[model samples]
Target: MSDLTRRAVIGASATGLAATVVAVGPPATAAPAPAAAVQPVTRGAALYRRGRFAKRRTRAFWVAGPGVRLSMKLVAVTDLSSGGARGSLRSFELTFRARRRGPEQGTYTVSRSQFAATSLFLVPTDASRRTYRAVVNNR
Candidate 1:
Protein backbone atom coordinates (compact mmCIF):
# COMPACT_ATOMS: atom_id res chain seq x y z
CA MET A 1 0.00 0.00 0.00
CA SER A 2 1.07 3.58 -0.69
CA ASP A 3 1.35 6.33 1.87
CA LEU A 4 -1.69 8.29 0.73
CA THR A 5 -4.02 5.28 0.73
CA ARG A 6 -2.71 3.96 4.02
CA ARG A 7 -3.37 7.34 5.61
CA ALA A 8 -6.90 7.41 4.22
CA VAL A 9 -7.73 3.92 5.48
CA ILE A 10 -6.39 4.69 8.90
CA GLY A 11 -8.31 7.94 9.03
CA ALA A 12 -11.58 6.26 8.02
CA SER A 13 -11.07 3.38 10.42
CA ALA A 14 -10.55 5.79 13.30
CA THR A 15 -13.86 7.46 12.47
CA GLY A 16 -15.59 4.01 12.26
CA LEU A 17 -16.29 4.51 8.54
CA ALA A 18 -15.54 2.03 5.77
CA ALA A 19 -12.88 2.77 3.15
CA THR A 20 -11.94 1.19 -0.17
CA VAL A 21 -8.84 1.88 -2.29
CA VAL A 22 -8.29 0.88 -5.90
CA ALA A 23 -5.24 -1.33 -6.07
CA VAL A 24 -4.77 -0.77 -9.83
CA GLY A 25 -4.17 2.98 -10.38
CA PRO A 26 -3.51 5.93 -8.12
CA PRO A 27 -5.17 5.66 -4.72
CA ALA A 28 -8.86 6.61 -4.53
CA THR A 29 -11.06 6.63 -1.44
CA ALA A 30 -14.32 4.66 -1.07
CA ALA A 31 -16.60 3.48 1.71
CA PRO A 32 -15.42 1.13 4.40
CA ALA A 33 -16.11 -2.58 4.41
CA PRO A 34 -19.28 -3.86 6.08
CA ALA A 35 -19.32 -5.20 9.61
CA ALA A 36 -20.16 -8.80 8.61
CA ALA A 37 -19.36 -8.78 4.90
CA VAL A 38 -16.99 -11.30 3.46
CA GLN A 39 -13.78 -9.93 1.96
CA PRO A 40 -11.31 -11.45 -0.46
CA VAL A 41 -7.92 -12.36 0.94
CA THR A 42 -4.56 -12.34 -0.82
CA ARG A 43 -1.84 -14.99 -0.81
CA GLY A 44 0.30 -15.84 2.24
CA ALA A 45 -2.61 -15.17 4.58
CA ALA A 46 -2.35 -16.86 7.99
CA LEU A 47 -5.51 -18.92 7.31
CA TYR A 48 -5.16 -22.56 8.30
CA ARG A 49 -6.64 -24.15 5.15
CA ARG A 50 -4.13 -22.40 2.91
CA GLY A 51 -1.49 -20.41 4.69
CA ARG A 52 0.87 -19.88 1.74
CA PHE A 53 0.21 -22.47 -0.92
CA ALA A 54 1.67 -21.93 -4.42
CA LYS A 55 1.70 -24.17 -7.50
CA ARG A 56 5.10 -25.20 -8.87
CA ARG A 57 6.46 -27.28 -11.75
CA THR A 58 8.44 -29.61 -9.47
CA ARG A 59 6.51 -29.97 -6.22
CA ALA A 60 2.79 -30.24 -5.60
CA PHE A 61 2.98 -27.85 -2.64
CA TRP A 62 4.46 -27.12 0.78
CA VAL A 63 1.98 -25.56 3.18
CA ALA A 64 1.64 -25.36 6.95
CA GLY A 65 -0.44 -23.54 9.53
CA PRO A 66 -2.11 -23.69 12.98
CA GLY A 67 -5.78 -24.57 13.22
CA VAL A 68 -5.58 -26.04 16.69
CA ARG A 69 -5.90 -29.77 15.99
CA LEU A 70 -6.04 -30.97 12.38
CA SER A 71 -6.09 -34.17 10.34
CA MET A 72 -4.47 -34.93 6.94
CA LYS A 73 -4.89 -37.67 4.39
CA LEU A 74 -4.13 -38.48 0.76
CA VAL A 75 -7.67 -38.12 -0.49
CA ALA A 76 -7.11 -38.82 -4.19
CA VAL A 77 -4.45 -39.16 -6.91
CA THR A 78 -5.01 -39.16 -10.66
CA ASP A 79 -2.46 -39.64 -13.45
CA LEU A 80 -4.04 -38.09 -16.55
CA SER A 81 -1.11 -38.57 -18.96
CA SER A 82 1.31 -41.47 -18.61
CA GLY A 83 3.83 -42.77 -21.10
CA GLY A 84 3.40 -46.33 -19.89
CA ALA A 85 0.26 -47.93 -21.29
CA ARG A 86 -0.87 -49.58 -18.03
CA GLY A 87 0.81 -50.07 -14.72
CA SER A 88 0.10 -49.84 -11.00
CA LEU A 89 1.42 -46.85 -9.09
CA ARG A 90 2.18 -46.15 -5.42
CA SER A 91 -0.08 -44.07 -3.30
CA PHE A 92 -1.79 -44.00 0.12
CA GLU A 93 -5.03 -42.63 -1.26
CA LEU A 94 -6.96 -43.97 1.72
CA THR A 95 -6.20 -45.50 5.15
CA PHE A 96 -3.59 -42.78 5.73
CA ARG A 97 -4.28 -40.13 8.33
CA ALA A 98 -1.94 -38.01 10.42
CA ARG A 99 -3.17 -35.79 13.22
CA ARG A 100 -1.40 -32.85 14.79
CA ARG A 101 -2.31 -31.05 17.96
CA GLY A 102 -0.62 -27.74 17.26
CA PRO A 103 0.89 -26.45 14.01
CA GLU A 104 0.32 -28.81 11.10
CA GLN A 105 1.55 -29.31 7.53
CA GLY A 106 0.23 -30.98 4.36
CA THR A 107 2.88 -32.12 1.89
CA TYR A 108 3.96 -35.05 -0.26
CA THR A 109 6.98 -36.99 -1.56
CA VAL A 110 7.12 -38.12 -5.22
CA SER A 111 9.71 -40.88 -5.69
CA ARG A 112 8.53 -42.94 -8.69
CA SER A 113 7.71 -40.36 -11.37
CA GLN A 114 9.42 -37.08 -12.11
CA PHE A 115 6.17 -35.18 -11.61
CA ALA A 116 2.76 -35.58 -9.98
CA ALA A 117 -0.24 -33.30 -9.73
CA THR A 118 -3.30 -32.96 -7.51
CA SER A 119 -5.68 -30.27 -6.41
CA LEU A 120 -5.77 -29.30 -2.72
CA PHE A 121 -9.49 -29.33 -2.18
CA LEU A 122 -10.94 -27.53 0.83
CA VAL A 123 -14.44 -26.93 2.15
CA PRO A 124 -15.34 -23.77 3.93
CA THR A 125 -16.04 -25.17 7.38
CA ASP A 126 -16.11 -21.66 8.75
CA ALA A 127 -16.28 -18.14 7.43
CA SER A 128 -12.46 -17.93 7.36
CA ARG A 129 -11.77 -21.33 5.80
CA ARG A 130 -10.60 -21.66 2.15
CA THR A 131 -9.08 -24.03 -0.41
CA TYR A 132 -5.45 -24.30 -1.51
CA ARG A 133 -3.06 -25.98 -4.01
CA ALA A 134 0.49 -27.31 -3.53
CA VAL A 135 3.60 -28.34 -5.48
CA VAL A 136 6.44 -30.70 -4.55
CA ASN A 137 9.99 -30.34 -5.93
CA ASN A 138 12.54 -33.20 -5.80
CA ARG A 139 14.90 -31.99 -8.50
Candidate 2:
Protein backbone atom coordinates (compact mmCIF):
# COMPACT_ATOMS: atom_id res chain seq x y z
CA MET A 1 0.00 0.00 0.00
CA SER A 2 1.10 3.59 -0.50
CA ASP A 3 2.51 5.18 2.76
CA LEU A 4 -0.15 7.91 2.90
CA THR A 5 -2.99 5.45 2.21
CA ARG A 6 -1.71 3.06 4.90
CA ARG A 7 -1.56 5.89 7.48
CA ALA A 8 -5.12 6.99 6.58
CA VAL A 9 -6.39 3.38 6.91
CA ILE A 10 -4.73 3.02 10.34
CA GLY A 11 -6.25 6.37 11.51
CA ALA A 12 -9.74 5.37 10.30
CA SER A 13 -9.51 1.98 12.05
CA ALA A 14 -8.42 3.62 15.31
CA THR A 15 -11.35 6.03 15.17
CA GLY A 16 -13.78 3.18 14.43
CA LEU A 17 -12.37 1.12 17.33
CA ALA A 18 -12.71 4.03 19.73
CA ALA A 19 -16.29 4.62 18.63
CA THR A 20 -17.15 0.92 19.09
CA VAL A 21 -15.60 0.85 22.58
CA VAL A 22 -17.68 3.86 23.64
CA ALA A 23 -20.87 2.42 22.13
CA VAL A 24 -20.33 -1.03 23.74
CA GLY A 25 -19.40 0.38 27.18
CA PRO A 26 -21.91 0.35 30.03
CA PRO A 27 -24.87 2.66 29.45
CA ALA A 28 -24.38 6.17 30.79
CA THR A 29 -26.31 6.78 33.99
CA ALA A 30 -27.95 10.15 34.59
CA ALA A 31 -26.96 12.13 37.66
CA PRO A 32 -29.41 12.16 40.55
CA ALA A 33 -31.20 15.44 41.13
CA PRO A 34 -30.11 17.53 44.10
CA ALA A 35 -32.33 17.67 47.17
CA ALA A 36 -34.20 20.91 47.68
CA ALA A 37 -33.18 23.20 50.54
CA VAL A 38 -36.03 23.85 52.92
CA GLN A 39 -36.73 25.78 56.12
CA PRO A 40 -40.15 25.73 57.81
CA VAL A 41 -41.56 29.16 58.57
CA THR A 42 -44.48 30.67 60.46
CA ARG A 43 -47.20 32.23 58.32
CA GLY A 44 -50.23 34.33 59.29
CA ALA A 45 -49.58 33.77 62.97
CA ALA A 46 -51.37 36.75 64.50
CA LEU A 47 -54.43 36.11 62.40
CA TYR A 48 -54.43 32.50 63.52
CA ARG A 49 -54.25 33.50 67.17
CA ARG A 50 -57.20 35.83 66.67
CA GLY A 51 -59.30 32.88 65.42
CA ARG A 52 -58.72 33.71 61.77
CA PHE A 53 -56.50 30.93 60.52
CA ALA A 54 -56.97 30.43 56.82
CA LYS A 55 -58.10 26.84 56.42
CA ARG A 56 -57.28 26.56 52.69
CA ARG A 57 -54.28 27.17 50.47
CA THR A 58 -53.45 30.70 49.38
CA ARG A 59 -53.69 31.50 45.67
CA ALA A 60 -51.70 34.22 44.00
CA PHE A 61 -52.42 36.97 41.44
CA TRP A 62 -53.93 35.51 38.28
CA VAL A 63 -55.95 38.55 37.33
CA ALA A 64 -53.84 41.44 38.64
CA GLY A 65 -51.65 41.65 35.51
CA PRO A 66 -50.08 39.60 32.75
CA GLY A 67 -48.53 37.48 35.45
CA VAL A 68 -45.49 35.58 34.37
CA ARG A 69 -45.69 33.96 37.81
CA LEU A 70 -48.28 33.10 40.43
CA SER A 71 -47.37 31.86 43.87
CA MET A 72 -49.34 30.18 46.68
CA LYS A 73 -48.55 29.31 50.30
CA LEU A 74 -50.43 26.95 52.55
CA VAL A 75 -49.49 26.78 56.21
CA ALA A 76 -51.45 24.09 57.99
CA VAL A 77 -52.01 24.95 61.64
CA THR A 78 -52.92 22.44 64.33
CA ASP A 79 -53.74 22.92 67.97
CA LEU A 80 -51.51 20.49 69.80
CA SER A 81 -53.24 20.88 73.12
CA SER A 82 -53.90 17.76 75.11
CA GLY A 83 -55.60 19.44 78.07
CA GLY A 84 -56.29 22.81 79.67
CA ALA A 85 -53.39 24.99 80.71
CA ARG A 86 -52.33 24.97 84.37
CA GLY A 87 -51.76 28.71 84.45
CA SER A 88 -54.20 31.59 83.77
CA LEU A 89 -52.31 32.60 80.62
CA ARG A 90 -52.94 29.54 78.46
CA SER A 91 -50.53 29.10 75.57
CA PHE A 92 -49.38 25.96 73.86
CA GLU A 93 -45.92 25.61 72.38
CA LEU A 94 -46.59 26.31 68.71
CA THR A 95 -44.95 24.81 65.63
CA PHE A 96 -45.09 26.07 62.08
CA ARG A 97 -44.84 24.39 58.69
CA ALA A 98 -44.72 26.46 55.54
CA ARG A 99 -44.83 25.45 51.87
CA ARG A 100 -44.56 28.07 49.18
CA ARG A 101 -44.55 27.57 45.40
CA GLY A 102 -44.60 29.71 42.25
CA PRO A 103 -42.59 32.92 42.51
CA GLU A 104 -41.54 34.25 39.09
CA GLN A 105 -40.70 31.78 36.31
CA GLY A 106 -37.34 30.05 36.37
CA THR A 107 -36.71 29.99 40.13
CA TYR A 108 -38.22 30.58 43.54
CA THR A 109 -36.36 31.82 46.59
CA VAL A 110 -37.13 33.16 50.04
CA SER A 111 -34.69 34.71 52.49
CA ARG A 112 -34.94 35.10 56.28
CA SER A 113 -35.03 38.89 56.07
CA GLN A 114 -38.36 38.69 54.22
CA PHE A 115 -39.97 37.12 57.26
CA ALA A 116 -41.15 39.26 60.15
CA ALA A 117 -40.06 36.63 62.67
CA THR A 118 -38.22 33.34 62.30
CA SER A 119 -37.09 30.59 64.64
CA LEU A 120 -36.17 26.91 64.52
CA PHE A 121 -39.54 25.26 63.86
CA LEU A 122 -39.45 21.65 64.96
CA VAL A 123 -42.39 19.46 63.94
CA PRO A 124 -42.10 15.93 65.28
CA THR A 125 -45.85 15.40 64.94
CA ASP A 126 -45.72 16.13 61.20
CA ALA A 127 -48.85 18.24 61.56
CA SER A 128 -48.42 19.95 58.19
CA ARG A 129 -48.07 18.95 54.57
CA ARG A 130 -46.11 20.75 51.86
CA THR A 131 -46.51 20.36 48.14
CA TYR A 132 -45.77 21.93 44.74
CA ARG A 133 -47.33 21.25 41.37
CA ALA A 134 -46.59 22.68 37.92
CA VAL A 135 -48.21 22.12 34.52
CA VAL A 136 -47.35 23.29 31.02
CA ASN A 137 -50.63 25.18 30.58
CA ASN A 138 -53.67 26.15 32.62
CA ARG A 139 -55.77 23.09 33.34
Best by TM-score: 2
Off by over 4 Å in 1: 1-64, 78-132
lDDT string for model 2 (7-89, tens) is 89999999999999998998889876554433334454352231222223242212111232223343333333445332212
Q: What would the per-residue lDDT of candidate 1 be over residues 1-139, giving only the tens digit for each residue? A: 6467888888878665322333355667988878545323323213212111212222323222322224344333322132322222321111122232212234322111232322222322223233222222111
Per-model clash counts, in order, read: 14, 0
lDDT of each: 0.30, 0.34
| Candidate 1 colliding pairs, count | 14
| Residues forming the 10-long window of minimal summed lDDT in candidate 2 | 130-139
User: Cα-based RMSD of the predictions, in order?
Assistant: 17.4, 15.1
